[model samples]
Target: YRTAAASASLPTFLLVGPSGSGKTAFATLTERTSIAQTHTSTQPLTIEALLPSPHVPASSHYRSPGDPAYERSRRFLLLDTPGHGKLRHYATASLSDPKSIRGIIFVVDAAALAEEPGLNEAASYLHDVLLSLQKRYTSATSSKGPTGIPVLVAANKMDLFTALPANLVKHQLEKAITEVRTSRAKALRDAGAALSGGEDEVDEEREWLGEGGEGHFEFSQMQEIGTSVSVVGANVLGGKETGSVDGWWEWIGENL
Candidate 1:
């Protein structure tokens, strides 16, 4: 009964990332089919969206276009959460209990990721998101384990001259995430010591973002826990010559 209700819900994709990363822009473009001027979001927004033409949902590839089930499979929900540091609780809460969430799209400004602060902030937030997913996967009691909720690292603002290419964006993020994982583990150890008045085993394995080792963190490591991470580049705004997100839409279609 409960499982059936959950299965009947729309396939939802949660849009998350740091502020000014074009999350709202991409969300609006996806919902409206054209870019609109968007202000920073103060609250979460939910929008119903259909897969655009020329992109077929993976689940409906064998069905004809006119089939109602095929069309219905193309429909899903885009849940945009506030990306501000103080308002990210909405995203975290949603991740903690992802009832209908089918995927996560973490939008990031490609240009911003070229700098130190922007890179660090994005990496930190991504680390925590991945960790939450890890916890969910590892703690599942079901013999079959939890369903994998894949992640799409949407590299946005490709129109900017400073924007990193999609490949570099992936590499940079992986490198930065390695640092984030190390720092986080160290912080957890220190906190545990302070609380216990001595060194103590904190079960760091559960908190670690990827395979436990000194090896560089790669998104592929997530596959062990059932999640797959992909990085796709697209631009939501910046005029006729540099505005498009077909890659993102296609990725969404594949997942849908």
Candidate 2:
């Protein structure tokens, strides 16, 4: 039991995104050192993985590679949740109960994000994820507040010719999330208006993401709530034999 508890307490990173956005591919590559032919996952998968060589964990950067503490710091759990719409409760549950969660990796198909439908789907899911984080921060009762959970927007499939660059991915997502925020607030108001009484007034403030203003929603806005967002471009396949996820791994090392 003690052994199991120790392993369970390892820092965990949540992997979430829209379907076919390469969440499973990234997980498989990280676990096996090679990408496999992955199908759409319907269930959440948890795997123990080590941070690869040459990239030291931020927590133990000063220690030499052979040190036991340095090696132990590289240990962590990768929790890959299903990206399918109906299967997202696993991700939501993890967010709500993020005891061991160190960070969130939201993978996106850079090329798909260039189109309207794909962009909207990714943006909508991302909006909800960030909103949950915002709510978690605002609802904390302690003076120091809860520990911040940073986010990494992994822009996958960068090898694709049509893939949007990392900067454009960041810009477009912010724009789409702004629209999603507006429509969601409008929806809440419409629903409340349809009701006769104000007995159950909707808490729009709680539902609103970022500062309550008419301005656009940027990832920077999350800073006020203690969550930092970053977008890094990478390819899980198509570049070289193994593809380039060095940037993603580096980001993970930094956060680790």
Candidate 3:
């Protein structure tokens, strides 16, 4: 979960959704084929200020499918914004570099959340992108404490069918991480403030929103069997703890 020693101001990831929820191949199909790590040369990682507005639907751009010089250097600056309620009316996302917009994935389509979770519209665009990400990182970390911006709501495709099934997506992500850790520990114990997962859990949580994972994922119920680990996206097509979760080696490890 990246024990931040430094080097965290380089995360400009924003990939809204709607049409073909792959967000324009998420940087050459999952960041150059399942999140790159193959070195070469010619540099191709410098995505900044990705403005996406025009009715949020597939605004393609996934460079290096096999040509156009490569060398990626452990890079990740993807942005395919657009598809926020089919444009031509309401809109947002136009705030320059708030330390690289830290995080916001919001890419869900799970057969439209199994046909109706909130009268589906991707659950009203994931509750308006989680209330605009808890009100823009609680006003950008209300005096800098949320630690370098973070937010990730990825519910993408779900293998394009039958909707959620990773144990009902880990019982709806363990009931929203136990209601966002007791509502941020009762809003920091009613003002006294001093928590992350609130008071104690030891692992200061690494990934929940700005996914890619590090640690923290509760919700179980298929215990009789063995091997467990879930919450979704590991090429899931019915994978309750790595069983036969299909390919991409289980893509939902956000921050891990």
Q: Which candidate is the best by lDDT?
A: 2
Local accuracy of candidate 2 as per-residue lDDT tens digits, 77-150 = 88999999999999999999886899999999999999989999999999999999999999999999999999
* Tens digits of lDDT, candidate 3, 173-245: 4455445544544454544434453554433222122222334424222121111223334332233443332
lDDT of candidate 1 over 126-158, digit per residue (tens): 999999999999999999999999999999999
| Candidate 3, run of 10 with poorest lDDT | 50-59
Candidate 3 segments whose C-alpha is farther than 4 A from its true place:
1-26, 30-103, 106-132, 137-152, 156-167, 190-256
TM-score of each: 0.94, 0.95, 0.27
Model 3 whole-model lDDT (C-alpha atoms): 0.39
Model 1 scores what on Cα lDDT?
Answer: 0.91
Q: Evaluate residue 80 in candidate 3 and report its C-alpha lDDT on the 0 to 100 scale.
A: 56
- Arranged by TM-score with the best first, the candidates are 2, 1, 3
lDDT of 3 at 227: 14
Pitting candidate 2 against candidate 3, the one with the higher TM-score is: 2
lDDT (Cα, 0-100) at 72 in candidate 3: 22
